[model samples]
Target: METKKHALLSASSSHKWLNHGPIALLEAMVPEEESSEAAEQGTAAHAMAEHFLKLKLNQASVLEDSIYHDEDMERYCQDYANFVVEHKESLGENTLLFIEQRLDFSPYVPEGFGTGDAVLISDKILHLIDFKYGRYYVNPENNTQLLLYALGALNLVDSIYDIEEVRMTIYQPRIGNVSTWTMDTGPILEWANGELKVKAMQAYKGEGNLEYGDWLGMTKIKAISKDRAKHHLELRKYQLREAHLLNDEEMAEVLSHVDDLVRWGKDVKEFAQKQAVENDKHYPGFKLVEGRSSRRYVNVKSVEQRAAEQGIQDIYQHSLLPLTKLESKLGKEKFHDIFGDLITKPLGEPTLVSESDGRPEIVKHDVNADFK
Candidate 1:
């Protein structure tokens, strides 16, 4: 008898698939290697930091042309350094601010990631501050770049220090305002080990492929819209029936079709609106545009491979490796829900997902495995 190879099953149905529509479309439109190249060229902060750290001087220059002109940004950096130094005593001796420092997380990726204008590191507290020179309104509480730096720092210092709280700040110097979030290392680590690990596996397996009719493509969109329409119709009918419980049999029969009636009404309205737009010569036909946000899913193996290709040798030296068997046994839906909630919460809200609000009491460390 020949032995059959059993395929590994994912704990969460949502986990085995990518959810963000824009990323899915981009992945479909561009090849993986090409997308990676675009990502590398677009962001030179990592590269610049790596170069600056090699210098033996106490100061270095980092430039972002989009944020501000070179001279203006340099001036802003000087002002920020002075501000931190003026308030140095309040920030505490163990806390470091307005200093150019590189954190070594793993051997493959070194002190390449840079902290912005300031960092606060007390015995058990680590904070990252970014200075924005632009006039446009920005909510830094949920800023991804700040969070990435926090991740790098957490990986470096968590094991060495009894870190109690980690904070990230976005300082809009032009607006004279700041947004900040305090994070707990324990829950973040748990999320990394659980939900992030599953996402990583999916990315590594190249499961992002979706045909037109696949659930992740056009087919899923139509199916979901139809399902939502059906659900709304059913709910409306149930409410109407309950309201007219004493109606005659004929009236009840009419009421029974209320859901269908409402659905038809909505469909007619949509059809008319679309027709009007089509008839207008100046009007552009409806276009499905991808959103402007980026969705980051974990791909530990790919990340490891990329690191190795870049001559990174000490991946798991400082950081913990994926606890495969242990992670596999945990429920997938639970992990997705936990991470999803963290990602979807709006900025300034009293949730782990939004860290911009000045209030500090809302931070909680509960871990759930249930998918919602």
Candidate 2:
């Protein structure tokens, strides 16, 4: 497995830390977690893209061996490679292509560095392409990560190339999205010296106030994908269920839209609570009040010292952290790397779900099968 070095204020995580600088402090307490399967898959896709881009651009590159390749990955990666190289070709002979380029934006962001997927530079244009394998629709406009990458890329050839404008492109082939955001060199340098420097300092020191809904942030692509899936399933189910298969009770249960109802109920409750708590939004028939809480320690250290002074022996009990909390703290990759072969996910209790759910049904056992 290839290991990656992640800086405290890495460009990839610029979105999180930039929004609320103090999160960098909170994250420092937590170890790097094991990357989720999706993250690893994305890495594999990047490797594949690098392989193809190198081959297409006449640069020596090896196709990395990994378990994450699929038909979609191959197709998307090839297309992205083609897009990058083609864009370079269109820019003419003056354009130079750099793949998987190492970028250092530390002048603005302290100790900051990142890898640009593709950097095509001409005398007057510095084109930075970032390939996102995920389904999320990453907007190119004001994308902090891409902006930082563009800055880093510019720093590399700025003195040599009279790059008048920097064009940052987010090439997300999976979602058929190709977005570009452009900024003149003067404005970018101004932002770098002004906003970027301030934010980077705040992030470096982990000093800014926490942003509300940081944890609640969800990618637009996920929401889009879910809605699209639900729409298709809703339309398809009508055709599939032309004839009734269930009795009255079962039919009524299906008609209740239990899944949607449960989801909506939870969402509404959560949404209202967040609004009332965070924004002080006053909703009809609802008032903000402190909820019930079990007693714990105001300060664990203070309580411990007091207990010791009062001769309160055995005041502590030890137990392993819950898996979910541990996973969140350590990250999926680090957790798995440290505790490989020690963790297991047992079969969950089966429950009725809509046909649109991705999980496969458990095989049913027939008692009469042996007799046959």
Name the top lDDT candidate. 2
lDDT of candidates 1 onward, in order: 0.47, 0.78
Q: What is the TM-score of each candidate against the true structure?
A: 0.37, 0.58
Q: For residues 180-292, could you state the per-residue lDDT of candidate 1 as single tens digits? A: 77778676566546654454455435444433322322222322244334543554443554545535764555554454455555654544454456554232665434549
RMSD of each: 23.9, 16.6
lDDT of 2: 0.78
Tell me the deviation in Å of residue 47 in model 2. Answer: 0.2
How close to the true structure is residue 186 of candidate 1, measured as C-alpha lDDT? 74
Clashing pairs in 2: 33-330, 33-331, 33-332, 33-333, 33-334, 34-331, 34-332, 34-333, 34-334, 35-333
Cα miss at 363, model 2 (Å)?
Answer: 40
Please tell me which predicted candidate would have the highest TM-score against the true structure.
2
